[model samples]
Target chain A: MRILIIEDDQVLAAGLKVGLGLAGMTVDLVGSCAQAGEALATTAFDAVVLDLMLPDGSGLDVLRGMRQRKDRTPVLLLTALDEVADRVKGLDLGADDYCGKPFDLDELAARVRAIGRRGGGRAAPCLTAAGIALEPSTLSATLNGQPLALSRREFAVLALLMEHPGAIRSKGEIEDRLYGWGEEVESNAVEVHVHHLRAKLGREKIETVRGLGYRVQVAP
Target chain B: MSSLRRRLFAILVAATGIIWLCGILWIFVGAKAELEHVLDTRLQEAARMVDSLVAQNGPAFAAAASAAATPERYQRQLSCQIWSLDGRLLARSGSAPDVSLSDHAAGFSDRRIQGEYWRVYTIDNPAKGVRVLIGDRLGQRDQLAVDLVKGLSIPAILMLPLLGGLLWLSLGRGLRPLLAMAVELKAREADDMRPLQTQHAPAELLPLAAALNNLFAKVETARRHERDVTAFAAHELRTPLAGLKTHAQIAMAAGDPGVRQEALRHILLSVDRATRLVRQLLTLAKLESGLAAGQSERVCVGDLIEEIGAAAQPSGKDVAVRIDPALRDFTLTANRDSLAIALRNLHENALQHSPEGGAVVWNVTPDGRGIGVEDEGPGMPPEEISQATQRFFRGKRQTPTGCGLGLAIVEAVLREMGGRLVLENREGGQGLRAIAVLPPATSPCP
Candidate 1:
């Protein structure tokens, strides 16, 4: 899942970036509402972790702006204001979830994954396409009931393709999902990851159309 | 006497009882004098009647006067006597004493007859050569005066208890508002800061009620301020703690030694930031507690600056700190601890805002009333200058790591030491200048 964190605290923001990245999510960070709005306008994210307090303005303004623009990316509010009223106000403002500050890293990651999964229109925790299954929670995969080892990038590429079977995802979209802002993208990194994914899942499992993109084949 | 009702009731009842007693005494004295006069007049009338009868009916009538009856109303009260001009006793009534009532020829006199006091009136008929006397006992006149006094006083004495009861009840009715106010206050919850009702209060208690309500309002404002500070402190502490926990988790999970080292460094940074925030909060709390400046001492500005500079230099920002030579040996009488806190906050604020290799300059004000700290950083907007000293008030140029308590603590400490903080943009328009203005009465130590 690709996630964006909007927080003013640099140390906490950095820590969250590192922590969530290790949890198998591509995490991006913006420190203010203005930066967050710019990032959201440019790139599509699976989920948003928003801090209510920001140096520029409240995080709710960002959420309100996003919802007003008909953007439905899932948002998880993180704040030090643990009052019931604060929580209710945040949730009523189109927030998908709320987490108070000083929270456990594992729990935050799970909630992010849950909201991200819901945004993709999936009810199950695992993604299955063309006889290969991927468990996003554990970042592990299986082909025809046999466990298969995959690198994090390879797994991310396969998961994007398999989210909706037979749906074509362009190279730019896959690269956007694999990397966040300021993360360097090497030449043809997506093509390399896709090439490795096909080798593990069988070449017929993923199809590349002429001058378009790649997609996971649907089971017959 | 402390109770208003008791005091008023006592005063009223005592005044009324004293007046009643005075009235009874006046009646007793006045009645005694008037009774004596009336009895004397009756004696004279009786004496004249006997004399006239002696003259009209001659000696035979006079001889029958001893058996003749006195007026029915005065039958036992009056006594009469008749005697010839030769000083011999002529006739005496049955109730009269047998001795001569008086030796005077023809006037009223008081005489003791047969060891009994009498008020007598004498009439002499010159043509007939006889004297007639009528007398009344003085003791009986005194008894009538006593009866008059007893009649007036018995009712007054009996009415005292009833008067006291009425006074007590009336006083209670008059003071009902005070009691109601007490009950209202007593029944209030400790956190209830609502004002006391004053609109319908009695005129006498209006000032007291208004004062108590004012006190309640002030307490409520103070309590609200305390709650806000607590909330802001909790909010400030959470961010650093969250960073610490997240970084610790990163340090534990990372497989690469470089990432682990980076995570450990972040953990240390988080701990330091948290420690600084906690210390700042404690200093702010202590200043807010209204502790008066304690034990003034002579502090050299040069030494104080040097000490803070040494402690703060570890940040390694490469900023140049220049202190005015005029303030090097200058000494001032102040509370050393609080003064240090104020100066330290100002110094930290200056260093934090200065650019790399920039200058932080310290100088005493030209007028000698205060000291100034200048930083080569973004000065605050003119509109935000007034609000800069408020707790948690971060300016538009606020850095992400700032907790916003620095200026607030400086202002509080300066205020406690009878001083103030004045913030302004530098004249050159490149940096900010903060001045801690000491009390006007303070003078540099010689």
Candidate 2:
């Protein structure tokens, strides 16, 4: 999952980025309301972690702007204001979830994944197709009841493909989900990760069409 | 008498008792004077009647007077006597002593006869060769006045207790509103700071009720301030703690040694920030409690500055501090701890706000009434300068680690020491210069 954190505290923002990044989510950070608006307009994120008190204005303004634009990106409010009223107001403003400060990093990651899964219209905790199962919570995959060892990048690539088995994901869309801002992306990074995925998950699961993008199909 | 009701009651009762006493005295004096006049008139009448009897009934009246005959009604109150022209014993009533009633031999006179005091009236009849005397006892007149005073006193003495009771009851009725107010105050909960009802208060108690309500309002405002400070402190402390927790968690989970090193460093920074905030809060609390209050000591400005400057510097920034040499020997007679806290905050603020490797200049003001700290960095906007000292008021250019309490503490400390804080932009608009303007009394040491 790709996530954007709108927070003004530099130390906390850095900590959240590294922590969420290790959990197999590409995390980008913006320190003010203006920057958040710009990032939201330019990029698509799977989920948003918002801090209510920003330098220029409140994070609620950012959430309101997104909802007004009919952008249904899952927003999990992460703020220092843990009061019940603060939570209620954020949730009522189209937030998908609320997490107060000093929260457990594991719990935060799980909540983000939950909201992202729900936003994708999936009810199950894991994605399964054709004897292959992916558990987003543990970032683990199983093939025919055997556990498979995959790098974090390789896992992210496979998760994106397995979300909709028969739906095509263009190269650009996959790259957006895999890399955060300021992280160096190699020219063939997607191609290399997909090649590695094929060697492990079987090539018949994935198909490429000329002048289009990559897609995966479940066995009949 | 300290109680208003009791005092008023006492005054009223005393005044009434005095009036009653005066009334009885007036009646006693008037009755005594009237009794004397009537007795004198009766004596003259009785003397004249006997004189005429002696003239008409001649020898027979002499024989009657010798028998000492008197009217029944006047027997004890008055006496009659008859005497010949020669000095001789006169006929006397049973109540009168046997002696000449008067040597003058005519008209009203007072006489003492045979150890008895008498008021006597005498009539002379030279042609008839006889004298008549009427006498009354002085003791009898005194008894009548005493009896008359006694008649008026008995009822007056009896009414005293009733009068006192009525006064006390009426006084209590008049002061019931005050007692009700006291009862309402006593029954109130300690945390209930509501104002007392003034609309229904009595006219006399209006000032008291208004003053009490004003006091309650002040206390409520103070309590609200305390609550807000507590809430703000909790809110401020949570963010740093959250940062510490997140960084610690990241350090524990990082696989690469470089990432682990960076995370550990962040954890340390978070601890430092939280520690600073806690220490600042403690200092503010101490200032509020007035600990070491009003104890001023002569402190050398140069030594104090050197001690603080030698202490911890802002990590990773090498801001230079230039203290004017003229201030080295300067001293101030002020509260040592408060001055230290204020100067330390000012120094830290300047260092934190100064650009990397920039210089912070410390100097005395030209008027010799203040100290100045100038930093070479982005000064605050003019509109924000006034609100800069408000608690937790971070401006548009708030720093990441600032808790927004530095200027506020400085302002509080200065105010406690009878001084003020003056914030303004530097001359060229390159930075800000903060001045600690001391009162005239605390200008400098000789």
Candidate 3:
């Protein structure tokens, strides 16, 4: 998952980007409402972690604008506003979740993962296919109740495929979420990550469309 | 007489003394003349009786007069003499001198006898061809007048001390309420703002008591506001403290250098937030602490907006400065520093809510007297607009990083300048539009 962080405080935004990056998700940051709007316009983010107060304007200005354009990317509001009514307003404004500032980074990562798991119009945090069960929050998978360890990239590829069991995701779309700015990508990076995922969870669980991309199939 | 009781006592005693003295002097003047008239009548009757006795029994009266001795009290006051038609000194009283006492002008005469002033009366006996004279000293009538005045005034002089004591006591009783008020005021604690009791107070002192009560009420209100600000300050500080703790814990627990570096960055951010909060809190307290009131100076509105643009540029350099055409030369009467503070707050508020590339608009309102700021940020609901200016009121989930005193400082400054702050949603739900209205200057509108 690649998440965009809209925060005015440069230090905090940098810290959040690093913390979420180490959790195997690519993170992008913008310090003002204008930058956030521009970034959102050009990129398709899996989720957005928004700060309500920004240098140029409130992050809500960005949020409202995104909603007006029918951009339904999941949003998790990360602000210093902790009141119940404040959370309600954010939720009513189409935010998927609300988290107040001084929050735990681990908890924030989990929530973002939770949003990605529930993507593709599904509501579960765990996906099961071909006798392989995956928990996106823990980044762990089980084959017939047997535990298996996967590298960060391998886990990311599997989570994406598990999230959309029937849809084919192109290699370019997967590359966009797998790496962020300044991160070098190889020609076979997606193929390499998928090869490891298939070795651990059985190659039949994922189907490759010639000249297209990959998808996870439902169990027989 | 500085004391209420003493002043009343002095006035009463002095008035009584003057009136009594005037009445005594009036009676003494009128009675003195009437007394002299009666003494003169007695002198004339005595002279006629002696003249008749000498004429009716001339040899016998002379022999009886020679034998009679004058009483001591009457000796200096009276004397009698008889004269014959041939001018013979025929008979005289023992008190009379051997020389003739008067020329005997007939009814009354003044004469000098032995260096003493004398009043003399004379009677003529035509049948016997003789005249009689009686003379008394001028000093005698003066003595009588002195004796009569003393008799009337002695009692008044003796009663003066008693009257003074009574006046002092009554005046003290009349002024007791003021004394009670003084004692109550003196005994009160320094912070006490309770009203002075008005019951049992004199009608003259009720207004004073009521005014003191009003003062106490105002002081109490000020003290209460200070307390609320202090309490709010304590609560708001916890946000920075909580942030600091979160970052410190992360830095300590993390093993990766990248993770530690990230936590350190957060720690610095938390410190900055705390510092800003402290600075804002101090500014707001100073404004609400009465340093923000009563400074009327001529401030050009255009220049003032420019100053705000410069001071707040650090917050948002992209804030587009706008001045209504009519406001380019507009000037208003206000304290430059206070108005500058209000304008800065308004600008920061707009900057914090406006979108990227959105202009923080500045202008003179349609009326040309009010200075205004507008933005294209996400606007708030109508219900929360009224509460935005209250102290320590950070907005809901939309609450930003701030001390929450920005709008409050703006309000205090505007109100102290005899102006008001009006906040409304920007047209079409853009953002907030805030105005601070002050008295316009003498300069003509552009």
Candidate 4:
């Protein structure tokens, strides 16, 4: 799964990135509403973690912007404001879930996975296409009842592709999934991850889109 | 609760009863005097009648009565007698005493005869050489006076129960609104602080209701202020707590020594931030409780300013401190420690807002009535001066380590010293100005 975390506190944000990254989800973080908006326009993320209090503006502004643009990505608001009125207002303004500060990272990850599944129009935290199944909670992948071993980046790439079976993923968008802000990026990192995913999931499962990027074709 | 009702009834009922008893006593006294005067007139007329009969029918009429039934009421109620003016009684009625009733020479007199009080009238007709006396017992007159007063009192006696019933009903009706108000107060929810209803209350109770409502309004404001402060303090503490938790988690999860060391450093920093917040919170509480200042003492402004100038400089760093010469001999009566804290906070604010090379300037007013300080950095906006000293208020720029209680503490201390913390913008709005004005020496208020 791909997720974006928008929080102003650097230490908390760094911890969230590490925790969510270990859960086998590719996480990109931004500190302001404007940066989150720009990242949303440029990349495809399954869910967003929003903090109400931000350095530039309120996190609710980002949620309103996404909803205004008809972006259906699920949003979970994480804030220090635990008042019921604040929670209800955030939910009324198109937030999928609300968590107050001093939150448990594990519980936040569970909620993120739940919202991610709901965003994909699925009932459970498992994405599958043509018998290629990925369990988000355990980060386990299997092909036709046989377990498939994959690296973190390869698992992230496979999870993204399996979320929407026939949709094409641009190389730049895939690169955004594998890296966060202030990180060194290798030019062919996405290609290497896809090459590894194809070897394990079978060659025909992921197809190249020529100059565009890559896609996993649906079986008839 | 019922005392007010009982007091009203008891006082009013006792007053009316007193007035009725006094009226009955007045009537008894007046009737007794009038009855004695009427009986005296009857005695004089009886003496004249006996005198005329003695002139017409002489000694024969003298034997006419031991007492005859012809004029029974007069004969029974009064006694008649005639005397020779010498020392002898010539004619007498049966009811008159056998002895002379009086030793008087004329007119009317009171005499005791045979152990009964008697009212006697004596007429002297020297031409006839005889005296006539008419006498009645004082006991019978006393009895008549008692009967007259008793006859008048029956209606007043019968009216008592009716008056009591009316008084009770009127008093109950008058106090019904108060009872309703009591019930209204009793039925309220524990935290319900809405003003009491007064629209249907009686006019006499309006002031009480209004006073109660005013108290409710003040309490509500206090409750809201307390709630806001609590929430603000919690938020302040939680942010650092969240940071600490995150850093601790990262330290536990790190596999490399460098990463673990970095995480530990962040943890220490979080602890320091939390500690600073808690200490500031305690300082604010001390100032708010009005106990930290203790007692007022003589404060020498010159010595205080010199100490402030020397101590306020940053540790291991040279920060210029300037005090106006006019402040050298200035002295005031105030709480010394409180004054020191206020000055230190102001100096701290000036230092915090001043730029790297900028200096803080402290000066006394030309009139020598106030002390003012200014920072060299950009001043605050005009609109924020009103709320600058409010507790837990941070500007939108969000300065680092701004617990937002520094100015509030200074303001509280100044207020306790019978002074105010005045905030203003510098010339051309370049920097901020804060002034503290002390009470004049001659003023009585502390």
Top candidate on lDDT is 1
Decoy 1 TM-score against native: 0.66
Give the range of the ten consecutive residues with the poorest summed lDDT in model 3 chain B. Answer: B61-70
lDDT of 2 by residue, B268-386 (tens): 98898988888877777777787746688998876787777778465479788899986886798988778888888888888878899898888989988888889998998998898
lDDT of 1 by residue, A117-218 (tens): 999998898999778999988889999999999998898999999899899999999999999988899979988998888888888998997688998889
Give the least accurate 10-residue stretch of model 4 chain B, judged by summed lDDT. Answer: B64-73
Ranking by TM-score: 4, 1, 2, 3
Q: For model 3, what is the error of residue B55's alpha carbon versus the real structure, in angstroms, after optimal superposition?
A: 6.3
Candidate 1 lDDT, B209-318, residue by residue in tens? 88888998999988877765555555578888999999999999899788789889999988888777778778888888866457888889878987888788455588
Model 4 lDDT tens row, B348-415 = 77777777777778887665677788877677767667757877755544455566677888888877
Comparing 2 and 4 by lDDT, which wins?
2
Among incorrect, acceptable, medium and high, the docking class of model 1 is medium
2 or 3: which has the higher TM-score? 2
Which lDDT values do the candidates have, in the order given?
0.86, 0.84, 0.75, 0.79
| Estimated TM-score for each candidate | 0.66, 0.65, 0.49, 0.69
- Report the C-alpha lDDT of model 3 over A1-220, residue by residue, as the tens digit: 8999887555566666766776778898887777888888888999998987654456777889889999989999876657687789888888888777667877888888777655557777777777778787666778889988987787778777777676798999898888876789999999988888888777888889889899887855
In order of lDDT, best first, we have 1, 2, 4, 3
Q: How would you order the candidates by DockQ, starting with the best?
A: 1, 2, 4, 3
Which candidate gets the maximum DockQ versus the true structure?
A: 1
Q: Lowest-scoring 10 consecutive residues by lDDT in candidate 2 chain A?
A: A204-213
TM-score of chain B of each: 0.71, 0.71, 0.63, 0.75
